[model samples]
Target: MPAPRIKSPALLVAESGADREGHGLRRTLGRFQLVCFGIGAIVGTGIFVGLSDSVAQAGPAVVVSFVLAAVTCVFTAFAFAELGGAIPVSGSSYSFAYAGLGETTAFLVGWCLLLEYGVSVSAVAVGWSQYVDELLHSLTGLNLPHALAAGPGDGGVVNLPAVIVIALASVLLVRGVRESARATAAMAVLKIAVLVAFCAIGFVAFQDGNLSPFSPAGLGGIGAGTTAAFFSYIGFDAITTAGEEARDPRRDIPFAILVCIGVVTLLYCAVALAAIGALGGDGVGDRPAALSHVVNEVTGSAVGGGVIAFGAVVAIASVVLAVMYGQTRILMSMSRDGLVPRVFEKVSPRTATPVAGTLIVGVVFAVPAAFASLDSVVNLCTIGTLATMVTVNIAVIALRRREPDLARTFRVPLYPATPLLGIGFCLYLIYETGPATWFQFAVFLAAGLLLYAGYGRRNSRLGRGGDQGLTPGDAGRVRQEA
Candidate 1:
């Protein structure tokens, strides 16, 4: 359906109230830094923790899954580039829906965004715990007890490291965005470096035979693998949320989205292929193993794997930083619109960061990380991101028709065809996720809808969307409309 062009007062993107203008977060990050953030977010979990699940779901066919998943994202990535360029705001899909699809859709999109960034942050925390435990056991021959290190799914009492990581990231977010991004970029380099080293070491031990029987379950297996593989791709989209803060939204943002995805995909494929090569099929190396296990098996030395485990620890911190930063930004956008409570939008006067929102979101992630099943939450995160991408694809088409003359700095190529392909890819993955994911998503959306109707609808600036308050660009747009 074509979305209505929303000239709503609520849609005037509020200042990222924390930063100073111009030199502020508004277009401050360059392409390289933006790409690093994307990599920082993408390279961690999908490689370190998610690989086992990808193997379980798709077996040797996971390589196929990676390709399929990357294909799907490439389509959606194009649409995101276009939309991110047009709107260039922090809300990501929420802001996109506001301008192109109106307040209600914007509300729901914001809710889904919450699911994508928030739950994913929790999931990353769970992943963080696993690596921390791995590092401890290998280095010190002593580790946190199983209860404190593992999640419910793993029959552990709690994931304390996960909680701690969340807490630490919260502090950084409260510090500020640019500061957090720099820290995350440094950690991201370490994570990639570790993985690259592992890949190089394992590559020498590669056996060509492992490539045989690649598609054990054929396309079905590969499809499942692709869906599973897609989980790692989540962080690349989060980079789009930095649109408002980017130095050049029209050029840099699109490059970041695509370039980041490309970089991560290559890394994942290399890591997966290298791991499989170093360990034979049905080997203990392929069992319910952390990434360190694969490294250990190939090297015949636990020390190398121990280093990989340490690398995993660094990777998790990077993941938490990128994911938490995305979460706070989206919430800031929501708070500004009065959809969520207003206090969340408050920026720290000193750091110019949304300290309150960061703390709240940090605590929210901590709960699940401290107590919930990592595997289960990971699935939830997958569904939320896929669902949002579907919305982005739909919104891309809707906006093009509704505002034909709107200055789109970057447009999705091949007319509607590219985004339509993106929509199809997104839906297939959504279906591939099957019923349980759908059920959870339904409950999440329903709950969000209830909140929207009860609070957001009444308080929405759209209903009385008369120029109440606006900055210069926003005021100009309003006057032009009037």
Candidate 2:
């Protein structure tokens, strides 16, 4: 068998342009919408659901952990800015890898991205269930039965609400990107409003003593919490997945990525300070509905708690929409490269979206959301995302060296130094994730390699002597659409 060739950077750009103009996905997103899409994705379960665990692990110093994680995310966000400006393609780091590294490496990156997006949606759904249950109990003094609300490990039959939320998000995505983006924007507004309320009400009862001995768990604990907190920032890259759908992708995608990072970081820090200041680390960190719980404790208002719960539900739903949208697009990109089934690349003429692909992805994760305990998936999402970030940082440097003439709408401010630090921080966070995550990451890669060897390697379009050739299945689907 002939070895698959590395796709040249110029060829990758050309193919992306072709995909835009030739019976491909519509470009309906503007800069503001892109920014909204990003914020909607970035500010979800990690803040509402995951923050308590982070505070527990790091004590009052969890605020420091939030900063540490943001700093780590900022470094990678810079790398993503440069690459998104230059590439502006749907596959994100996977496509960047193909342009700089080769098919094998890109395949592995894409596979990890699959895990990152899938597990992330499942995890977010699980968090959504928590908030929904909270809201129900607060409003009516009734909660979901344990068997219906909890995952198996939690001694439940299935998380039925989690599956329902995933299904609803999938339906919105199938309607079209414009509708999805609008929904996301509305939900993003609600989410931000709720956080602002939380911060405002929480400060009224702030106690300096609560923040005493801030680093009770010390540097090691902060490091551990930073790893967990990193999960909050994972959805920023989901912005890059919408590159082909953006009106001025080269300019808008990069700008949106960095802006999303700044906005989300500030919100995270503010909320962390509010929760810990109002009730202390132990008081806020050890509970499931910590943020809402803090608001109730501080203001003594059950209605405020219900409002927060409602906001959290919206936040998680927005995340589900964004992440699911990202997953389908990435799969579509890989399919266009002949690394996966071509059906994923087929867009519905009626919706201008990948309907068939979207349904498949939604169903795949919804099952897990229904029956699985994905609390552990949070660390897995962090590790997989950090791994992708490492690759993206390397891709930026490699592209600069190999394609210096490529016009980038945005460039990394400090060049090699920034990308290097991005890589370093990602590695540090990966280490903090510990040996178990490393083993899981390795096993995932091993499985990807096996799948690639069995299929992707043999069927790659570049190997077949074509650029963006539709598979037989895709060809028939296009004819029908035409």
Candidate 3:
């Protein structure tokens, strides 16, 4: 068998331009909409629900853990920014690997991205169900029965809310990207306002004594907290997945990413401090819906809690929408490369969207979310994400060496040191995720390898000499017509 080929940087740029102009995806997004996509994906379950567990693990020191995780993400975001600007493809890091590494490595990165985006959407949907239940109870004093409200593992027949939310988000995506972006942007604004409200109310009840004896669990606890907190930062990279959809991808994608990291990090840290300050680590950690509960306790009313719960419902739905968008786009890119079925690459002429791909991803993810236990799958998602970040950082270094003259709208400030630290931080966090997660990741990768060997290797267009006789422009036009 022939070795897997690496796509040249110039070829990638040319092909992307062709895809943008042909019957491919539309480029209607601007900087504001792009930044909203990042925020919409980032500020959901992690801050709204997962904060309690992080606080439990690190006590008052969870604030520090949030910062550490953000620092790690910032380093990686730089790598993403540089590449997203230069390559400007829907595949994000997967495309970066293809351009700088080889076809095989690109397939693996795309496979891991499937896990990162697909499974994470399911996990977020499951979290959304909980908030829906909370909001319903607060509003009408009625709670969904266990059989209807949760998955089998949680003593329920099916998580109806999870399925419903995923379905709604999928419908919106099928309608079109512009519509989805508008919905996500609105939700982003509402969710940010909700968090700000929570912070305001939480500060009113703040006690200095609650923050005493910070770092109660010591460095070990902080490390564990960092691992937990890192999950919140997972969705920030979803920004780069919109490379082909952005109006001016080279400038705007990089700008949106940096803005997203700064805004999300500030919100996370503020919420952490507020929750700990209002109720102390132990108080906040003991509650199920910690943010809502904090607001209710501080305001001495269920109305406050109800509002927070409603905000959570909106916030997490946007996450499902945005992350699902990312997943479908990745699949579309992989299909275009002949790494997956061609149906994924088909763009609806009417909607200018991948309707079939969107529905496929939504249905595939919704089933696991409705019937299976995904509590542990969250760790699997996090580890898969960390693996991709490591690849992205490496791709940066590799691309710089391979294409020194490629135009970059944004560059990693410290170059080698920044990406190296990103790799190191990701590896350390992966270690902190424990041997079980490592084992799960290995199994997933093994399965991906077998699938690639049996299918992707035989079907890859580049392997079949599809681009052999053509220039980059011709290759892209042929792909569009195919």
Candidate 4:
């Protein structure tokens, strides 16, 4: 039999090593842009839409759930920062797996990420509909028709606004990365300002009685809530997907990752506290629009609710932009490796953007946002993310052993402890995702394996021995000085 193929770490490094000096895509992002990407990716639906579900699950102790999720994210974020600094590639966990494990493992990670980012974009798009409908109702005294404003499960024939927003984001991304980053930064500022306004106003109306029976469902409830709240932290890894575009991938990627996680964690904890305190946990759950409901309840005014609804609409757009951006870049990376079609890897000479990939991603998620119920997509994303987390932590440890001499801009503290705990926490969350999710995930994995067998394994660049170990290329003129 022919030797079983495995993508060596050297090959993985060579692929990203070619990223310097404008090998394929344009490098336009700085550290601030990177931080905004994470913030934009993270602070949307989970707070504006999903918070109510978490509140319902844990009562007032949803605060504990947010904290638990943040702590877990911190562990995984450290591992990601370390790996991203070393490899500095667009594939995020997929690239990390390819370097530390094998090609098969890398393909599996990429497959999981495809679902994670694509469904997340759709889920956030569906979330945007909630706020858009609320804003319209507040201003025009008319709600969008159920058939046009919601998915079938939510009693609507289709979600028109969700599809519209995805289409708009696709146009923006096709324009270029700098343009997308600028828009993301502007929206990030607007959403953060709105969230601050909410906290400020909510504190004035805070009621102590609302916190009574804080852990209404006990520890089990808090654990369950953490599973949902964890979704809030999903986009921090999107920062790592910009390694090729980053001005200084090693130093900036790690810094941006840590900053985004720290800032978002604090914001989430505060928002959870303010929301439960102002509206009461029970009052917040299942509300058609959670943040708007909180503002309306506390201020006794519809204007504040209207303002919040507008901010949420913008926030969800930023999320769609950031998440879709991450997805397309990951597809591009896989394509360059010959794991997928070369069309995905094609960059427009004029725009330096992946036009085909961006359009395809937009269309793929748009269909789901237009018709499918996405409550399941959120859980599916969490399951995929936990799996990525497990691989990332292991990749960190493996890289340390394999490349002791590699220059690292950041390292996970306490060595094996951080990654080990990261693995343990990810597994715990996987268990909490329930049996139904596992079955769905298994189906998804099986589909990915079939695709790999049919196409990827044969066409992979490593299989053909092309630039597998950093052979001189156009990008070799200006090497990164480590």
Model 3 agreement with the true structure over 1-482: per-residue lDDT tens digits: 86559886556656555344664788889999999999998989888878987998899999999999999999999999998888778888888889877888899999999878999898888889989999998999999898988888878899999999999999999999999999999999999999999999888888999998898989999999999899888888888889888888888999999999999999999999998999898888845678988988888899999999999999999999999999998898888889999999999998989999999999999998998765667789999999999999999999899777777888899779999999999999999999998999999999999999999989998888775544756444423311
* TM-score preference between candidates 1 and 3, better one: 3
Give the runs in model 4 whose Cα sits over 4 Å from its true position.
Answer: 1-10, 16-19, 472-481
Per-residue lDDT for 323-355 in model 1, tens only? 888888888787777788888777666786778
What's every prediction's RMSD, in angstroms?
Answer: 3.2, 4.6, 3.0, 2.0
Clashing pairs in 3: none
TM-score of 1: 0.93
> For candidate 4, lDDT tens digit of each residue in 1-482?
56545554445556655345666677788988898889999999999999998999999999999999988999999999988887777888888888787788889999999767988999999999989999998888899999999989888899999999999999999999999999999999999999999898888878899898899999999999999999988888999999888888888999999999999988988888888888788888867679899998887888899999999999989999999999998999899899999989999988988999999999988998998775968898899989988999998888788767666778899999999999999899899989999999999999999999999999988888775455554223223345
RMSD versus native structure for model 4:
2.0
lDDT of 4 at 376: 60
- After superposition, which runs of candidate 1 have C-alpha atoms over 4 Å from their true positions? 1-5, 8-27, 284-289, 466-482
Candidate 3 — which residues are off by over 4 angstroms? 1-3, 18-20, 469-482
TM-score of each: 0.93, 0.95, 0.96, 0.96
Residue-wise lDDT of candidate 2 within 1-482, one digit each (tens)? 85536776556656666234554777889988898899998888999989988998898888889898998888889888877877777888888899887899899989989877888999999999999999998899899999999789668999999999999999999999999999999998889999999999888888999998898888999998898788888889999898788888878888899899998899999999988999998898768878889988877877899999999999989999999999998999899899999999999988989999999999999887888775768887888889998998898888888877766778898878988998999999999998998998999889999999999988898877888543554333212211
Better of 1 and 4 by lDDT: 4
> Is candidate 1 or 4 superior in TM-score?
4
Q: lDDT-based ranking, best first?
A: 3, 4, 2, 1
